[model samples]
Target: MVSDKMFTYISRRLSSIKQTPLPFGGLNIITIGDFFQLRPVKGKTAGGLMSTLMISVSTRVMLIRNICTSDGLVNGAMGLGVSLSSIQNGIPIKPIEHTFMFLGHQIVRSQFPLMPSWACTVHKVQGLSLDKAALDLGSTVFEKGMSYVALSRLRSLQGLTIIRLDPYKFECSDEVLEEYSRLRDTLSPHDDV
Candidate 1:
């Protein structure tokens, strides 16, 4: 949620400068997206604490053992951690154990469970419509229409959620912009009516 972080930064900056506040103190916001996907080559990762919080609050089940029964805690089931422990012998190696309740059973495992949700590259999701989507438009958007392609994955405005949407992310090469302007000029208002 780079956009969420940026929005927060802008809000704080404005408040500090103004000395007065706006409605909700300019904190009204909702962010949706997987945080562990591709990050900007030159930008720092955003929302690290928020991502941890989400993992601590998730509801699906994750199974650590490949042979575990698929009743509910499948290989990629998402769930919350019920308990945690650490085993150490003063050898500088300590493995943390996580216990989770899946389908009324407490499953304990030493290895970290794989997260069920994942962030994918835009190319992987192209041509597919998703009920809900979270997009990270960090400092770098390499190709023209990359942002548009990511956004178009959602079937409707209600299904679209954007993260880290800098104004520069919308900029394209001059040739692409010229073509866009031409297409816009060719559209007639009556065509839709």
Candidate 2:
């Protein structure tokens, strides 16, 4: 998986990639955000504004642990506010075997400027427009906002696809209560000490 830092440097150095020429140039596919549970790592904090958020290591580890176990448990039913960067990390560490082939590829040169044929984690594709998008909504953490980001990545919904999700296959925990309370306290409009 590529880190957010990787994108920062690569996006700038790869300016020529955009003009290299192809029906589909740059990154052709992208995975967007989800809101059922958490936001992206190094994202905004609880201020009702997306800018102040940042990724928390604890949140990252928890999401990774959930992915590693293949059991999407979040402590409780109302628990919320999970981070995407952590979940992306977890999927591979705890990947599910499939009949289809799966490969991990990385763009080292930062000059090729091509949409990778292999699987890429969500963090790599944010803010990028794509010709096609295949979202892996495998866990219970699936939320509308996440879906929105993924679906809207493309100029149109022509090549958008949502993988099938199993309703009876996942579990949730109450740990999210802490997150909700924290966010509420931080972002609440009315406050006084």
Candidate 3:
């Protein structure tokens, strides 16, 4: 759910692009999201991203610099000890010498509290298809509806993987189950349109 304010930012950015060609030599724009999650930040909707807006060249440089490699021993080493020190010290490491270095910007993982990264919860990921996904089922008692939605996002069994599934003891009233059934039956795959 895109908010009016986010739409405004996008609209302005698009108009700017129309006036002048983007500096980056490419016309690629990418959008990553699970609409069922939280609606665009209270007025900022999620949708198309601008490939080239008016952001400073330095910002683009920073983005390129942050693409850490994660391949074999060298990449995995960064996740560990002493080697991490030499790495941070400006060792001349080649980009993505290991597969771990491949930062998949296209992935939109699930969001959770106390976690270091941003993610889209199951509720928001419904009706979507991913090339690959890592589902975080979270606590058992909370958000059963969301849990179902998250698992169903992938089109094929090959693309889905559960990160964790702790046992949950939940108490559901008959009414809650009925409502869930009703909503589940009423919503078709295309209802999101």
Counted clashes in each candidate structure: 8, 17, 15
lDDT of 2 by residue, 35-125 (tens): 2322455631221122223433333222221221235442111122334335644332222221221255432221111122244455444
TM-score of candidate 3 versus the correct structure, residues matched by position: 0.30
- The sequence of per-residue lDDT tens digits that candidate 3 reaches over residues 1-193 is 5533453355446647666323111234454654224222232111212223232211211111223345322211222111312455343333221112115544332211111113454433353556678877756326434565566567888987888765452233344465445445545676441
Worst 10 residues of 2 by lDDT: 107-116
- As for lDDT, the candidate ahead, 2 or 3, is 3
lDDT of 1 at 94: 23
Can you give the lDDT of residue 31 in candidate 3? Answer: 48
Q: Model 1, 1-193: lDDT tens per residue?
A: 2533454456557656666444123344454653222233342122111123234433333433333443443333334544335323211112235556657888655544444345666754554568898888876566655777677678889977877787667654464455345435544565331
Those runs of model 2 whose alpha carbons end farther than 4 Å from true positions after fitting are 1-39, 42-117, 140-144, 166-193
User: What are the lDDT figures for the candidates, one per model?
Assistant: 0.49, 0.39, 0.39
Quick one: best TM-score, which candidate?
Answer: 1
TM-score of model 2 vs. true structure: 0.27
